[model samples]
Target: MAEVDTEINGYIVPKNSQIFVNKWTIGRDSNIWSNPDSFDPERFLKREIDIRGQGFDLIPSGSGKRMCPGFPLATRMVPLMVETMIHNFNWKPKKGMKPEEVDVSEKFGVALQKAVPLKAIPIKL
Candidate 1:
């Protein structure tokens, strides 16, 4: 909640009122990002921005009081789990699905997720 009546970016925010930021819009803002809508993972290599709340550009897990409690564990465990899976099985997309055909569309709801979840066939090695 806002502490006092404050004007931010020309918008007046009432005192004690809740404020929400649309993270999606921030990611797609052309002013802050070049070709924001395009898939360019290399952009990160061009600049140094912290994801752990220090920098506003990337805070998917949030920061401070709102930070995800499992962020530390998740960060460490996810890569190991993925590595285990890759080592144990040969993976492929669902039948008839090409590498580029997989849907990358987002479903905006209580939580963001893929509109069409990836269906993979894992053959135990």
Candidate 2:
């Protein structure tokens, strides 16, 4: 691994070097993902994988010992937020739409988000 790193040192770069990590490409690598462009959350459901950063295959927060300190917080916050939304209401498309038909285009910035805000109807449960 060290020799490989040294060999590619000029082509690729370390954190302090001129080169930088292209997180977007890494996240959407077709070689690692089944349908890299698709937003199939189900792909992760049955797997023992998680977004906890330890598993680079699906590290939403990041990986390694220097990973996000907010990982545990986000872990707690995300599911709670989803649960709250699910328990409080039912979400559906505007009309004549299905989950699979939902567009998943992303816009990049400090963080990525849907290019078009997901328009869904929320009915009080």
TM-score of each: 0.70, 0.64
Q: Per-residue lDDT for 57 in model 1?
A: 80
Candidate 1 local lDDT, residue 10: 97
The local distance difference test score of model 2 is 0.73
Cα lDDT over the full model 1:
0.82
RMSD of model 1, in Å?
11.5
lDDT of 2 by residue, 1-125 (tens): 23334336366533444343566787788988888887777977766776776566666676776568988898899999999999999999879999778887878767455989989999999
Residues 1-125, candidate 1, lDDT per residue (tens digit)? 55778888998989977567677787778988999877787998999978777788877777788788898898889989999999999988899998777777788776566989999999999
Give candidate 2's error at residue 22 in angstroms.
2.7
Q: Which candidate number has the best TM-score?
A: 1
Clashes of each: 0, 0
